[model samples]
Target: MYAGTAKFPVRKGKNYLLRIVNAAVYNHLFFMVASHNLTVVAVDTSYTKPYITDILVLSSGQIADVLLTANQAKAKYYMAAKVYTTHSEANIDNTTTTAILSYVGSKSSTTPILPEYNDTATVTNFREASDVAILQAYHFHIDDVYTTDFPSNPPIEYNYNGDVDKTLWVPISGTRVKVNEYNATVQVVFEGTNIFQADKPSNAYSRL
Candidate 1:
C-alpha cells in the first residue's frame, strides 16, 4: 500500500534504480508502469544487462531491481503492482491495485490513474511485459565464463558384479506427535529410508 511519488526527484532520460520486494504472504507480484518500459538491471542481488520489459514478476521473499528511464516528458503514469497465482481457491478480490509515479517539474501535476481491475487490456499488457530476455542474456554471459573443458575420465565407475555384498532396503513413514510446549498435535515425517538387509542376491538386483 506504499503508493505515491518517490521522495527523491526523478530525472528524465537518466536510468534510476528501482528496488522492488514482495512482502505478501502467498501472492506473487507483477509490477509495471503505464506506457513506459523498464530495463531489468539486477535480480536476487546479481547484476544483469539492461533488458527492456514492462512487468517484474516477484514471489514472496524475492527481490529485483530495474532501471527506469523517463523517455517522455514529465507526465504521470500509473505504477501498478498486481498479484498472480495458480491456486484454484485463491482469493483475488482484494489483490490488484495501482500507485502513482509522478514526474518532477512536469507541466502536469495530476497523478497517473490506472485502469480498472477487471480491464482486459491492462491485464494483457502486464502479461506481455513479463519477458525474461534480460535474464536469459545474463545466463548466456555466465555460460561463456565456464569453458567446457570436461575431464577425460568419468567421475563415477560402476561394476555389474562387485565382491563387497550388503544390500539394503529402506521404507518411509510419518506419524503425529503431541507437543506440550505448543499444546497441539504436530505431524512428523521421516525422510529417506529404513534400512534392512536383502534376503537374497536376486532380491537386491530386483530392488535395484
Candidate 2:
C-alpha cells in the first residue's frame, strides 16, 4: 500500500488535478481530503462533469481523477485513502487499515490526525447511498442510450462448402432416490448435430 504526503504550492481560486489509482490485489479504496470538497472530474479514463463530494470509492484496478480547488491558500489538510473489503466468510483476511495517499507541507508541516476505522460509521452510511445512485445512472446510460450505435451486420459468411466426417454424440443420464433408501438409475436420451470440418484442404477433419 502506497501512502505519503504531497507538497505543492497553490494559488487560491485555481483548480488542481488529483489522480488516484487503486492497485490493491483484492480491496477497494475510499478517498477523502480533510475539510476540502473533492470535485470528481473523470473516472476510468473517461471525462465526467465535476461532482463535489467529501468521499470517493475506488475499486480494484480502477482510476479516478478529481479537480481539487484550494479555495484558501497556505493551509494544511490531510488527504486520506483507506481500503475496503467485501468478503463475508470467517476465514477471509480483511485489512485492518491501509493508507494510499496523503498531503504534505503547507503553512504547517505537522500531520493531521485521522479517525479510527470504527469511528467511520457515518462516512460509510453517506457513501453507500451515493455509490448506488452513481452506479444505477451509469448502467442506465450504457444500456439505453449508449447501445444504439452498434453495427448490425452478421459476423460470418454462410456460403462456404465443406466436407463431412464422422459425427459424435453423448447421452445424458439422471437418477432419483428415496429419502432413506436405495435409488434407481435412469437413462435419458441426448441428440444434437455434430459436424467435423477439414483444415486448410490438406489435413483431416476436426470434430466439434
Q: State which candidate has the highest lDDT.
A: 1
> Model 2, 3: alpha-carbon shift in Å?
12
Q: Count the backbone clashes (under 3 Å) in each candidate.
A: 0, 1
**Model 2 residue 80 lDDT score:** 65
What tens-digit string does per-residue lDDT give for candidate 1 at 1-208? 3345343456677777888788888766667776677777667778654457666667787778887887767866667776665544344744556655666775453333344434556556544444335345356553322223333342343232343223322212222122233444433322222223222223211111
Which residue segments of model 2 deviate by more than 4 Å?
1-4, 86-106, 109-208
Lowest lDDT 10-mer window, candidate 2? 172-181
lDDT of 2 by residue, 96-123 (tens): 3332222333454323234333335645
Q: Model 2, clash count?
A: 1
Number of the top-ranking candidate, with TM-score as the measure: 1
Candidate 1 has a TM-score of 0.48
